[model samples]
Target: MTTVDPTYAACPVPLPESERVLLGHGAGGQLSADLVTGLLLPALGSAAPAGPLEDAAVVPVGGVDVVISTDAYVVSPLFFPGGDIGCLAVHGTVNDLAMRAATPVALALAYVVEEGFPLADLRRVAASAGRAAAAAGVAVVCGDTKVVGRGAADGLYVVSTGIGHRPPGAAPSAGAVVSGDVVLLSGPIGSHGTAILSVREGLGFDADIASDTRPLHRLVAAMTAAGGTGVHALRDPTRGGLASALNEIAAASGVPVEIDEAALPVPPAVAAACEILGLDPAHVANEGCLVAFVAPERADEVLTAMRGLPEGGGAVRIGTVADHGEPGRVTVRTAVGSRRVLDMLVGEQLPRIC
Candidate 1:
């Protein structure tokens, strides 16, 4: 007879039936949400976070709120059109903190190297990371390195941990979004994911496509400075792209979100590429842009502030949080004046994409 663990047997909610982890679990979509709510949270028991998840955690330390975020980079083909794994690691962590309206203070980096990895390549990556950190106005204060046997690890992997200071009035969160809030996109979408996919598959197009992988802390600073308490939430559409980000915000805030399809800023190259690949631009990832939920009264000033910065020069109003609808619902008003429900990406569209 086989023995069953009491913890697994006694839980009121059933876990996923699948015995093995799937790639979709890391895709930051529906499967990922299920994994967290069903498996991870239950397993963690009292140790799990108490509220809705955010990109970074704001903890009060010594009477001051400190924001901390950690991310691991496993993007394949280390080098891409506009960035490499190292700089990406830095930017990613910084952006996570930025999403919470925090000012980044310092970073800690960790590296895992395969046994046969090249020293010159490692140095190149390190130099890139240093430059990125400098550009973001943050320092890598500490780090650790580990080596594993060949094939045990990829060529290299980087993990970045960011520490930031949250201002007294700065408390942007997904759950803070409210009905009648305006949705703003910092810039165009699909460029980053398209760039990575183009490089990975050797796709060619008329225009040059580059990954929009850059830091957005300064952009956030500007928005918060101008909008003040009106800025309710911020999110970087990365893994599951804009669709996933909006769905998350809606679910957390228990509000319906509606966007106009005609207003989405899809670059020509990205639009063409997505059409060819049969992928929705809304589901494509981005690195250098953010989604903002701001009160209508302050939306104009916030838009002006964002446009004043190069990073947010192309900012545009895309949609609004509805006053009434099914909670956690999202809909897109199509170009033909038809409305369709928009759900989060079901599975991985582009794997190892930042």
Candidate 2:
């Protein structure tokens, strides 16, 4: 088991004091946590999830543990570099199931389009969603469409629900993370967030940055095949990026997570963009990557397995779970060797960036 280094300190970021929902609440950070734990869960009462919230819920259905996930895509512009709202809907829901080590079986879509929205665009989105679902080896079995008055719907909105089957005895969850588990990142971070920002704001750069929107179930399957139960926890850092994802895992597992800042694989373009915008790469979003907690002994094997897949070609070991320190603590060992608390994203950096 790893021991906490003395260099780390308490988180310097203050807890949000707002009484009402803010845009940051949708950014998937500390504010989001407050919204869920404060309002949503209390309102849900007995219907709330018993443990830490996860990307998908595992329910016993007819003697089978079925994984179900649902997500809504309201990405601005409908289309962004490397992906569009349509395929994004499919990939997002599928990735959630994949985070639980589930094999995607079927998807359902619901579209809300404004009356004035172009029919051509709607057809384009449908075709794109079809292609994405087919490539992921899943089918869209059902759907609904609603057309609203102009400005009622923001061009278009897609809601996707995914059904998946978890392999028997394979349970990957945030709460399953433990001391000595090695933290591995599937690939680089911040690409999707930066790509969306660039296009939405019309900020052109010397090199093009594209959203990493793709299905990761196959990549996850490869990992489970190699690591089995040794892959303790899995999460796709989407909205609040790696920082929020890691913080949630640390809080759920009640362990200290420490990562080397220099070890994180951030693309140069993403890095430059974050630097330009005064955003932290750790707090930026990624559409098509995952963060994993693996048994320390099986880390190399799992990393190798991940690297073999095109989706995980840049996989790397970033950190470890510490046996000592405050529960739910996350620290970053900076380049100069000083350690500080790596808190969750405080507010909105890039809005409507899926």
Q: Indicate which candidate wins on TM-score.
A: 1
lDDT of 2: 0.86
Decoy 2 TM-score against native: 0.93
lDDT on C-alpha atoms for all candidate structures:
0.86, 0.86
Candidate 2: RMSD over Cα atoms?
4.9
Model 1's TM-score against the true structure: 0.94
lDDT of 2 at 341: 97
lDDT of 1 by residue, 1-354 (tens): 001112222343546576778787777677666666667767888886666678888899999989999888888878888888999999999999999999999999999999989999999999999999999999999999999999877799999999999987758988899999999999999998888888887887424888889999999999999999899999999888899888888888888999999999998989999998788889888989999999999999999999999999999999999998887888999999999998887876677787
Query: What TM-score would each prediction reach against the true structure?
Result: 0.94, 0.93
